[model samples]
Target: MSEINLTIDGRQVKAEPGMTVLEVARREGIDIPTLCHHEKLEAFGGCRLCMVEVESRGRTSYAVSCLYPVAPDIAVRTRSEKVDKIRKLLVEELMAHAPDAPELVTLAREYGADRNRFAREASFCVLCGLCVRYCDEVKKKNAVSFFDNGAVRQIKFVPEVAKNECWNCQECFAICPTSYAQAAYLLTEALAFPGQHQSVKRATKAAARKRVVIPIAPVPMTA
Candidate 1:
């Protein structure tokens, strides 16, 4: 494939045809925030926070950097007035779900997004799909996925798969932007699969039944 040259934030860079705009911009040390895009996984534009202004053939538009491909001879602006406004709205929207998320808070500061702009519907999940995508794409474990549709959608673990898989492997927990995947999994473990590992649960309950550690004060000093 021929080299693709593009201008990102006024810096000229050469990239391969398959590389997306976000990859090219990152190659040039450009900072583009994204909650969904992961290097190990395929480009998922679930979070439009990485939107950027693109000018091609005198036409200007915004595109999600993680999913949008780099076009030869196109000018890309990572930050712009319109782009910032769009990002600010996005931040505000996502913050509605995960108000206290560190990543969202940081983005709120940068984009001047007011967390309270929308009604407080704190589910503590921004639905970035980081955890779900990582679980499926990288770990190859379809243990968790988005449950429901529309406004009530949330991530959930398949009780059977989670019972056998999640306890030993929690790789998705670290990648979650809102830190809700862990808690969601725990909740699912509690309610979704009641009889899963009953013996283990019973043993844990039995162990918790008031065992006083009797301290023997210095067992009779050496003869």
Candidate 2:
């Protein structure tokens, strides 16, 4: 791919043809906040925390960095008064779904986002699609997906395939922003074996081969 030259936060950055603005910023050691972008998975752009101002051909517009590709002569601003306000609002909205998440709490504090500004609902899953993407893209299980729509949307686990396969390979659990899988798996175990749910954790750990721990840094809600 041909390389393109652009300016990010007033610093010249050279990037590949397909690289997104967020990718160029990260490569240039510029910190742009993100939540729905994982290096190992495809960018979803579900959270707008990485919004940046892009000036191309004299017109300036805000775009989600994870989805906006780099182009020649484009000027990108990762942070500004406008960008900060948008990031704060995105953090505040995410807090409603993941109020107690360590990453969410940390970002909320950093952005001065009020976690109590909205009503708190009890749910460990933030519906970030990390687990669903991991299952399909990495694990190739095709067993999990988001079900329903809008306010009622939630992950739908295919019990038939999951009961037979996921117990020994709960790798998706490791990538989840919140460990909602632990609770979900326990319920799956109970349904699979009426009296063996109590032993699910022990059995899973004993059979597990790969244990992935995602490190959270002080950045976006995903950290």
What does candidate 1's lDDT look like per residue over 103-222, in tens digits?
989999988999999987656777788888888888888888877656576666676677778889999878887667766666555444445576446433432331211111111211
Worst 10 residues of 1 by lDDT: 210-219
- The positional error of residue 208 in candidate 2, measured at the CA in angstroms, is 24
lDDT of each: 0.78, 0.73
Stretches > 4 Å off in candidate 2? 149-151, 197-223
Q: Pick the candidate with the highest TM-score.
A: 1
lDDT of 2 by residue, 1-223 (tens): 6789899999987999898998888888899877667898998888788999999999999999999988999999988888888888888777776676677778888888998887765555677887788888888886677776565767656666676678788887777665665555555554455556566555355223213111111121110
Candidate 1 residue-wise lDDT at 5? 86
